[model samples]
Target chain A: MKSLHAQHHPLADTGYQLTVLTQAEVEGAHQPLFATRLREAGLLPLRPTGITVMQVNVGKMCNQTCRHCHVDAGPDRTEIMTRATMQQCLDALRQTPIEVVDLTGGAPEMNPDFRWFVEQISALGREVIVRCNLTIIVANPKYYDLPEFFARHRVRVVSSLPHFSAVRTDAQRGEGVFGRSIKALRMLNEAGYGVEGTGLSLDLVYNPSGAFLPGNQAALEREFKQRLVREHGVVFNSLLTITNLPISRFLEYLLDSGNYESYLDKLVQAYNPVAAANVMCRSTLSIGWDGQLYDCDFNQQLDLLVDGRAPQHIRDFDLAALNERSIVVNQHCYGCTAGAGSSCGGATT
Target chain B: MEKATYYNPADLAKFGNITEWQPEMGRKFFDYYGEVFKDGALTEREKSLIALAVAHAVQCPYCIDAYTTDSLQKGADEAQMMEAVHVAAAIKGGAALVHSVQMMNKAKELSM
Candidate 1:
């Protein structure tokens, strides 16, 4: 693969004309046309497969407000899952043969019932994956012992570390986030989360701090391993490279910064049909805190409900109905189908 | 002389430079970028408009700069482009406000 630096440079001429479109102009004209194209790409109306992983978005409450966060999570948010909703999740898990229990949120740990839910799932003897924001472990004094709790359950920790450096990570996240993240990582390591040869798995997530898609996952993982080991003595199992979906706070960043067209062109031109066929939504089922089903986490955030003959909430979850149901998609689906493709687990292809 | 304290437009435009320290990754991004803009199920014109909309969604000055140009070159009129951005702003703003219901409920319970 050729380097991105060589392709688009400050001085390189790619024979493509660059124009500046404003927020109003883009919203009015380009969006409709883009939607039409998505339909042509066989991505307009998406369909679902089955419910393998039940992802419960615990809430919008988070300690940090990163610039590119798709969830737009911050300390100010309070939309947490109630105990009743959590009981619904446990009921679904008990009745279904769901393989993975994926938990997410502003900082899923911020939920008061987070431990109870984890304990219930762990008792069920199912695989559990936690989308940890890393800093939460050190954000509050009460959360200090979270490492021990996670280690005891053998929960797979998938934490976000935009970059290994303080400048880059802090820039996308917030001031001093990198320092706290490092401390949290060290604590996880102490609990045998990312140490080599340990069965406990700890993976890190990386999304581009700018408008473009992230680099190759394999290569980026190599660099992250080396830098983290040398600089911060941090270790992790894998680096899951994620593409910045053009939604939420990230979308605002693109338009506010004025690079929307080139970035979308980058995603569209890199549209990999192979990647599209293997999109995470094809096999994974995303569930909301209240038990509603979605094609993926992004769709969940958009409030785009899944298509099924029966009701879509967990209370009415029918595995067979969801298995045969079609996934809901739109123009934004292109972000996942583009290039190597993107998902919470990493590249689709 | 004291440096300008205000957020620089140039700084925003040069935001891509943050990845410069990793030239290998930079090259990979360029390759994916080249492919992302090529003609596919989406016409270059359609892709440009989507990028314009997403630029607002992500709020990248550099991306907004490049896609605004791309959208116009693809013959998207001013009204069309602004509408795409409004969709983004609506969703972006709505995402925040919709969750306020949760806050409202919490506040009510706390007051009781």
Candidate 2:
């Protein structure tokens, strides 16, 4: 079935096929439904909503240095959140009613005060999210009980699993990473994280290991469910289909491989306005490890701060002011606004 | 599943044959491809950088090799290219971390 799908959609590699025509293209062709759908999805192009979602960059430390890792994170990275920053984050939380607190870093778990920050935010009863690299739980014996710790605090755990197959996953994340991730998922599932009727949501994330954007999220979710259940007895709540942003190490890989032009064309042609209108940065607040603020994690890394009178660092967080501040964007912003739109959470559209 | 040959730099440099299965689509892509590389909303250099960054994010060896050269040719220095790749890494990393909520919630349900 996968092979058949690949055959029909030849753009599976570079994702640069012109499958859907524009209204102009159809006026010159026989088929028009494809063109109509493209128009409805706003793939034809237009600027969409611009809003601020405070972004924090906790640090540059990570447990895995996957092939496509944009952060260039590894154990070598010493940058991390200071205790002072954690206090700032808490202060911001207290003053701001931001819908989401997006805590990120090399591995947010690697931060010394990761749990404390989660505890504080959860105590305030705000939606607190922590980006977890699944292998971190198994990276060291000290972190073996992270599943329990995260559960105790009600912190949402978002993990990366590029594919259900071990080969593909290991290829990207390094040897043994896939096995540890699966073991971690089983641990999460046994705890009722991905099972039906459980509010404990365990949503797996996938990006194409190549140049293409992922196929339909719902369909891929079904395929993942079947494969995982049959092969590994794994289960998860949903699958987030994300387009790979053409920035960072991934960009290096593209240039090194001679696919730069083709891939960019794919992203440009696939731009979906619906995705742009609901981009995640509009609703999510990102906090750096030291409590500095940005519009999103992407902008945070670029050192693009929010514009307004609010505290730049978490130490002086004023939620109302930050929320009212305008977001800083660049051409890279198109990545989040293109096709189905991508965010840490999933497809915004 | 067909066993695919993963290319190294040496092998990739020798790569030249374009697949001929979709002649029409391939020609169309080439035409649009030319226009896309032209400076518009995105400059040619900017597009090259974006592609290089995405190649790493997607972990495509072929793309990584191709775009690295394209970015450099288009005047993107090593630092700019590295910075772009870092952007991809952060987003990818953040995406993974955000989903941990499932594990936390599940652990709570079972522990209780």
Clashes of each: 76, 62
Q: Write the per-residue lDDT of candidate 2 for residues A294-318, one digit (tens) a residue.
A: 6777666555566655557766656
Two-chain DockQ for each candidate model: 0.02, 0.02
* lDDT per residue (tens digit) for residues B59-112 in model 2: 989889778766643434456788999999998998898789888998899995
Cα error, residue A40 of model 1, in Å, equals 6.0
Q: Tell me the spans in candidate 1 whose CA falls farther than 4 Å from its real position.
A: A1-45, B1-112
Return the lDDT, model 2, position A8. Answer: 46
Q: In candidate 1, residue A138 scores what lDDT?
A: 91
For candidate 1, write residues B39-91 as lDDT tens digits.
Answer: 67876656777889899899777678778766543434466788889988999
Backbone collision tally, model 2: 62
Candidate 2, chain B, TM-score (2 decimals): 0.76
For candidate 2, what is the interface RMSD?
13.8
lDDT of 1 by residue, A129-207 (tens): 9999999999878999999999899999999897766776887888898899999999999999989887999999987
